[model samples]
Target: MKWSRAVHHVEELARRCDTPSPVPMLPVTGLWVFGDLLGEPRDLDWAHVAVIVDLPVDDVPWLDIPRGGQHWAQAVRLREPLSCLWRSAAGPVWNHRIVRPALVWDSTDGVRESTLSALRDGLGHSVRLDAPTPSALQTQLDAELAVSLRSLRRQHRSYDDQRWRPGKLTPHADSLWRATDGYLDLLDAVNAPQ
Candidate 1:
């Protein structure tokens, strides 16, 4: 199904379900939607939809997700918030792939502006919901890697005397060390080659 139509279909379903229009999405920087565009009876053609969003920024890690990949489209529960980050860790991630569509995104905007019709219509410019190019994808990955490395470095540099007392490590220092190590591991995973 067309990206716009798929978006419309979801909006209508949300309305019929007595939910809000332009459903809330994960506040993080990625294009996300619920699993199966169609409601329960997955036999419907509209239920299987593929949407390619051209992001505003190329540095987002969300761009690493692959189509039909683990944690792509998630199943939204009645009381669940639209945001993906709010889900339980054991739940699915996202089903969409990270594409490098040539479209340039303003750092200020996010997937909501591109996916929600209300925001899309209100926007002064247009966005191309299309597949990504190899070059664009690589560039995005590079940017993401750089950001992760920088974050790791910043965390490393944040250490100070407060973190360590004269004879032993201070409580604050130990906490900082743990946090820095945890973040460093995460960044390392991101930097690892696919």
Candidate 2:
């Protein structure tokens, strides 16, 4: 989907927050728990949830902490930094409406299967992030995942260059549009140029 469509989906996702969901559906794939320590990967609890909908800009990372009743759908100008997940230090926190900010946004289905649980178990609590066998944790990623990851990386990079930027400022309807923006293809995304 284009920029406008992405925003529309974001709002739609927020309204559905009352509906229970395990893994993030379609466009919403990245979610995390807000814990005692802000930005600590170790503190992620399976209980906390919320997914990020990628925006057109990569340079500006935005975090929207819902007030009392506000939701992700209501979040304005969404961009989250690709780093440690954090809970808001101040105010009443909405459990699942917030997400970990990431620069390298990985929304592929394979990532959801592999790492989603690790986050649930609390990455820092169960797994030794700096342990020698850290590589062992990533053994699940296969060629298929690699292609999808590569494709998303390229799409993000393309946005980095204002020249190739594809998202429009206003709403543009395209039935063929997608949150992945035609980038999640297995072969084309892999072979496509950056």
Which candidate tops TM-score? Answer: 1
Alpha-carbon RMSD, candidate 2: 15.1
- Cα lDDT tens digits for candidate 2, 1-194: 23233323333333343243332322333343233212333322232223443322221112321122123333322232112222222211121223232111123432322233333333423322222232332321223334334545644454455444566622222211222443333245334453
When summed lDDT is taken over every stretch of 10 residues in candidate 2, the lowest stretch is 59-68
Supply candidate 2's per-residue lDDT for 76.
26
Error of 1 at 149 (Å): 0.5
TM-score: model 1 vs. ground truth: 0.32
- Please report, in order, the local distance difference test score of every candidate based on alpha carbons: 0.34, 0.30
The regions of model 1 sitting more than 4 angstroms off are 1-81, 84-128, 159-162, 165-194
